[model samples]
Target: MATVDRVEIEQAQKLWQPQPGWLNTASYGLPPEPAWTAVQDALADWRVGRTSWEGWGEATERSRAAFANLVGVPVADVATGAVVSQLLAPVAAALPPGATVVAPEVEFTSNLFPWLVQAERGVRVRTVPLAKLVDAIDAGTDLVAFSLVQSADGAVAPYDEIVAAARAHGALVAVDATQACGWLPFDAARADVVVVGAYKWLMAPRGTAFAYLAPDLRDRLRPDAAGWYAGEDPHASYYGPPLRLAADARRFDISPAWFSWVGTAPALDLLAEIGVPAVHEHNVALANRFLAGLGRPPGDSAIVAVEVPGARERLERAGVRAAVRAGRVRASFHVYSTSDDVDLALNALTG
Candidate 1:
């Protein structure tokens, strides 16, 4: 009896095969070996016209059920999409005109763009200051959308607190958790709506994302955008009369690429098998190692500030491909990032 649950961990590690010099997992890494091979095997069957989406579809359903179980939610509430944008577009479309959306400065474009466009239409877009973002929500704030962990600075905001504050003011909370998955423990129990990208921390490919819709708010949310796939009847091709959408978050989903769904199903299955808590612990151990490697000096050191003199140039010269934002350089971490990757990144930063 392996009390540590190393059974799934071993299977996942063998399944998600990584390439050489692959420190860029935060960019996009393969899913664990077992799941990757399983997905590919399933895809091969689909491509050869041997097996249909039935097994994959059933697997997809099981994956979501497992995901919901991992997040402490009901199976019926989760929905899959080709990307987080598709799942969130419904929430964006359903927003009242001119409503204010509060977001942090460190968030990704996927979380910001959907709400920012509303500014031109009378929706007040407020970028909350880094320190006060948690306490900034008020009665007038229509919604507060942000990333659980900042992709730019690696600074994780107080997500639970932000949700509580925004909800107290009657504002909806939307979390873009692309960087948080596999790295952080995500319990969607308190979040009104949260989207996760499978490519990054989740160890899946691009165009595969999932959304968790808080059960209580499902009815209140209207799908401003809908398609045949979004309807309750997937086989409903008559198109004669208006078909009612799914009762759950599935109504928010649009054209889901079944292939991508097939790919994600096993990828997530690997995670579910390894267990979210264990994966998160492994990732945090890596994050702590890399953060400790960045030995930038204090005071005038703009290591974290919006602007830093020669820091970006120096890092580039040292072989670190850095993304410059607000005059700062940031490197992200994911599960496959081992101590060697951390040391290499640190060596580059220092040299």
Candidate 2:
């Protein structure tokens, strides 16, 4: 059962400086006041010439636990990273040379480029349309890379079906859930590797992200880029001469941004307290409202995309916040967004 309700979520929205009909969370999320409070407390400790290793470490671990909970996985499966690119570099490198990677061409370029770049170095990268993605995977394919939700058009991918097919062929699956993590419920345990950029939907600051690697997959891949922090006892890494890495997913973690970790604790706590199912329900309702206002069938996604010419200018003049992607205006919803916010965006488009 959810401990927090719509009233509590609406109250939490007050912490963020109210936007002028903001609906653009898909591009970037608004920071809550609690996140700032956490950052300020950490900075104050830093100013006193006192480093709270315990406090800092606890914050980092708490973030890992929180993300694990969000993805329905154990904390041992989660690895922290400075950003998606840094985390994905190891994942991309882990693939056997000459492996075939299947991906959608229209996905967020971060999810696309890493796999595509492998083409230059003996790997086969096949870019296909989203509808054709499942058919592209077969016995010859070694990896399948894709976003959980299409960023440009807000289309949800057939993830479970794709994962099942990929697994049947001995292909590893990598998912970028940055766009879908907080607003939609997914079984993270299904993917071999799940990466999330926390700043967007997870409601954390920039410079924070995480990757979840299956226990078996961790041992199978070569730890070529494992840094000093990858070890079980990161502090003892310098004191001892042994270059031992963690037995679990921690081996993939890079040096994390401490401040972002501090902020992440509270942000994730808020969502967990509210419950993802509740948040998903709220955002879906708003998305449906927005679609209905436009007289379109609901796509059952938090993002409501419409093709509008001069979208940027029109939204700007109307004080409506949205993202322009692939010539479409994308207005995304969060638990904080209300029916009014959807109506405001709809009116801006039609009026």
Candidate 3:
């Protein structure tokens, strides 16, 4: 039996409702009111010249610590990247000069491009079927990178099998956990690197995210494209004399996005209030309602393929703003989304 948890769920949905034609989470990621309130304060603080390198330095440390706490890891092992792109930097740098980076066939470029461009060092990138990923990480592959929940299908990958396979082949695993961050609970023990971009479910603004490098794997990464902050003595060192990189994952922290720190905190505070599991259940329930409303797909299709044209049109005709990608209608159901909101989306889709 599904527990009815419309209390905070309704608040989140009502606060972040989408207008017509608002389909993609990509184009219009709706954050809660509290998130906006936080960002507004951060922006005001920024305008007043309250944030500085050191101030942000402390903020970065705090954000990283918060992220580490969320992922169940020690703060010392966490790295703060202003954006998710740099989050992949350490993983790319850690690979051998000439290595194969294997990824699932369909992926957000966040997980694909960094490795694809690795040809400079003779690093080969291979696109494999998602179903075969567990069997595909043979001795030839150096690192296997992909998202835990693929963006296209909204299908959560079997993390345990993927990790076991990579470990069995002695390969490092880099998970683009942007989609799974709030949708599910993640175990850091299963992955060497778990990079989560905060914009989507964490309800943070763009340019805000964190990358968790497994404590044991922290020492193995070579900080490529590092800066002053990468060093332990960055504060006192001059002329970049024999630049020393940070011994911990803090080496990855270049600087900070002052505004995101401000805008992101309120929602984070709310997340702390509602709790992760409850939020996850809320999302799951909405997805279930939408999926159930889809009823039975055509004999062959399990869910609507996003690539199919008019998915947005069809959902719109039914009365809800929706995105059809891969093969599922990707809908956002937050703490604010009520049974009515779920019913609205489902009714619009199934009608």
lDDT of 1 by residue, 82-189 (tens): 677767776776688878888887667888887776666677778876578877789989889888776666666787789889878999888887767665676776
Tell me each candidate's TM-score. Answer: 0.83, 0.93, 0.84
Best by TM-score: 2
Residue-pair clash count for candidate 1 = 10
lDDT of 1: 0.67
Q: Each model's number of backbone clashes?
A: 10, 0, 12
Better of 1 and 2 by TM-score: 2
Write model 2 residue lDDT over 221-263, tens digit each, in one string: 6666577778887877756667788888888877667888889
User: Which is the winner by lDDT between candidate 2 and candidate 3?
Assistant: 2
lDDT of 3 by residue, 225-257 (tens): 577766776675445478777778878776667
- Whole-model alpha-carbon lDDT for candidate 3: 0.69
